[model samples]
Target chain A: MVEEKEQIRIGIAEGAILATPGTLMTAGLGSCVGLVIYDDSRLLAGMVHIMLPESPHGRPSHPQKYADTGIAWLYETLMEHGASHAHLRAKYAGGSQMFQALQMEALRIGERNVRAVSMQLERLRIPVLGADVGGNVGRTVWFELPSRHYLIRTARGDERQM
Target chain B: MRRLQVDPVTLDALREFGNIGAGHAATALSTLLGGRVKMSVTDARLCPFSEIVDVVGGGETIVAAVFIRIFGTISGNMFVLMSLPSADRLLERLLERLLPAPRKAQEYTELEQSAIAEVGNILSGAYVAAISDLCGISLNQSIPAVAIDMAAALLDIGLMMSGDEENQAILISTSLVHDGNNIDAYFFLLPDLDGTEVLLDILRGKIRHG
Candidate 1:
């Protein structure tokens, strides 16, 4: 019997993680999406902490700063760590419109980002198996490594999966 | 009991000042947000710290706040806060095309520090320019430092309005509108005896111009 004592923690703010098994957590999702990818066979999982859907071109404000750059960074990092693209799957959480001062249409950055991610994932041939997205309230998400199960909590309560 | 007060005349002048400042900010913000990111200068008041409304950012949140320290006339601080929600919106617009996650805006990483700092820089500079032109004073606007909580935001506000604030410090607020969210920009300028006189003179000039 082997016991894995080297559990690592991924703090979500604009960062990435790749672990064969570890706890990746991000708290407070408000119109921001948390991306999680897991490769079952390898027991490898990675998450990207993104604040926006796109980071723009030419002038990437902070390559790891926005969703556009952050997500790209996550994948590349995962690839570097030995995860096969074919076995990867994703789960996302958080995308809410809370402010009443912004235009309903203008505030759709969250939705737009979600769309962008879906397209990117599709292009990468990675399937999205589960997600808890879009709401008026903020949430916290924890992706349990090795298990590929997503634990989510909100002001309302806690969700066991997805 | 005419014990020095800010009346309709003062409020109007301040409001007008806000209007002009906001107009300038609108142009700058629009350029960045990819279109006209709506903005409005809500209310202005002359009071002490006790009168200022306070907000708290959960410890988990990292707030990007920019503070510009102004010398001469009104020696105080001017700040622009993304107010978490607004920050999220701004980042979403800033990075909608590069990543593969649900379109929702979520999860912030340390990678955002510089970007948020730059934003703080832009807003603080823009605000100082507006105020300087309006007051017609050549004041310096310092680069903003990123802060973690609402208390930090208020403390920044406190610095300028501090000192024998035995009396209340005036509060001038601007609400920047974007994607249905309101970003609160607080401007706190405390006039030393000299600053008071200068502010009054500027107020007089604005009235004359109007």
Candidate 2:
């Protein structure tokens, strides 16, 4: 008989890191982006759920709430915890346009968040292995560190592995 | 933006605002459905942005939500939420037929979606009219948008419009009950900090003059 691993749930504007024998997940992500970076060989992974694209005025009380700052924080934290910088890979999900009628530029927060996260990952030299983004629906995502399986579940009850 | 100090008097006034608005909404719903509708002001207070999902159930709780953006004298977001079962019941009443249980929101037909949106439009219109009359302010609303998804996903729009600096929101929560049908619906009014201050100022002025 095998034991079920522990699961850590990340809330809005929050992040978590897990090693082997654990899973990290975030739920009900609408316009928000759920980003995961992991070192497959080391079995270490970190995830951040970001709400906005950029943090105004440089730094805010909660850096994890923004894409640029949150990605940077996650990268540094993972590196500090013995994850190899060269071996780090990324996969992300969420960032959906929940309301399709508005059409205002400011209301396109979902699209903007996805662009910001992608740019940051590129600047940091982290390759994006998979992504599920830019739609008119919400998503929930889970990442298993040991198996390195990234699962995305859409609001319509469709589940796919990235 | 600085956090607006919500005094006890302001909280009470907000509750009263919710009560009157919800009362009008219930009447409008009752007339539309041709049934007795009862309303209750469940909770009106300052809630952290992170905990807003918990108010509905949880982050992952499936729900049917209608969103309307408020404009003019006071600007913010308003939402009408219902559990899937409650939404199904409401749909049955609106469409005049029994529907098979839906496994997910995507299973709803186009006609059903529009029906739900129309309900949101009527209820929010009535609620806003009551508030406008009470405050003596002009307000307008955008066309309602419907989303049947996780409660947190549907609510993120409200938090985004409320501004990133502000972590807490003044939530005026209300519930509607349809007599003889057991349909339960929730209403949330999330006004921005600036909007709240303006609303409170007008309310205080009316109190002083009276």
Candidate 3:
């Protein structure tokens, strides 16, 4: 049995694509979407901590911050790393409402982010295998590349695997 | 990346602004808890959005928070954060009057959550009132949104208020203490780039005149 103890943790507005054996983790996804693209056969996994749906005003300094650009960038990066788009599968978690009282449509960023991520995946012709989204909670996700599974842990200590 | 030009004069002015706001917020919090409260403006600067998660410990630090979005001349985001233990202490102090039994549960009850949100509402009201007076700006707050989650998650919402990741934001961080317990509280005020620019101009004008 191989002991896999290492993991890569990515921060806000960050993305990581790892071919390594360990798990890839991203923490504190409230309205943000933890979009993971995995090539099961090649053991290549990528995660982008996307905060906003789109770059409305202009291109951001960090391409990984917006769903539109970040998803595209992650797709291209994964493809360049010897992963075929045909073999890529998408999984996402987070994008909880988090704040209920703020009724402004703009403040409903979580719903928008989820929609944007799904749209981008559809545009790329990628199938979304699983998702855990839309609630007034926060989540942290850990993706294991070797097994191609994602474990989501909520702030309330509830755990879900996808 | 666009550099947010906040000169020394502007920084000093912002520090003064934060000091006055924190003073009022401290008093409001003190009145609620029936204890002495002290708040100090530690730093006021235009910082990168990515650094916000690191401000209140690391990204995954579990925290209780109240978030309010400002909409007006000083449009931005305001939030108060404290560790779960500190939050429990606050709930214990508040629930005595708010609840009949005043029992501490492993998880926060709805009333306990409301109490925490009310505390945040009061403190943010005081802070905004001071800023409106000093900057002479008409600022309105959205409804208070409360949550107990990871520090990183809350910070992400605060950063979202800024919109553009490339632009710099005004970060006014305050250290708060109550009854000598040294409650690990963080009061963050983040203004968008345009709002920050307007704020710097107002500060410059104030400094130049006075």
What are the lDDT figures for the candidates, one per model?
0.58, 0.83, 0.80
Query: What is the DockQ for all candidates, taken in turn?
Result: 0.03, 0.67, 0.57
Better of 1 and 3 by lDDT: 3
Question: Considering DockQ, which of the candidate structures 1 and 3 is the better prediction for this target?
Answer: 3
Off by over 4 Å in 2: A1-4, B1-8, B177-179, B204-209
Instruction: For candidate 2, write residues A36-81 as lDDT tens digits.
Output: 9999779799999999999875777778889988998899999989
Residues A1-162 of candidate 3: C-alpha lDDT, one tens digit per residue = 887666899888899988978888999898999999988679798999999999764666788989998998899999999998789899999887776667877668999999999999999999999999988778899999688889998777788999
Tens-place lDDT per residue, model 1, A1-162, is 675634444433346565645677766565567788777678677776555566557445444435656667777888888888888788988665433223435345556657777776777788899878765455677888667888877644445576
Query: TM-score for all predictions?
Result: 0.47, 0.91, 0.88
For model 2 chain A, give the 10-residue run with minimal summed lDDT: A99-108
Model 1 agreement with the true structure over B53-124: per-residue lDDT tens digits: 343244233344544456654665555555555566566666654433322223445455445656666665
Going through the candidates in order, the fraction of native interface contacts each one reproduces equals 0.03, 0.60, 0.65
Docking class of 3: medium
Full ranking by TM-score: 2, 3, 1
Against the native chain B, what TM-score does each candidate's chain B reach?
Answer: 0.73, 0.86, 0.84
Docking class of 1: incorrect
What lDDT is reached at residue A121 by model 1?
78
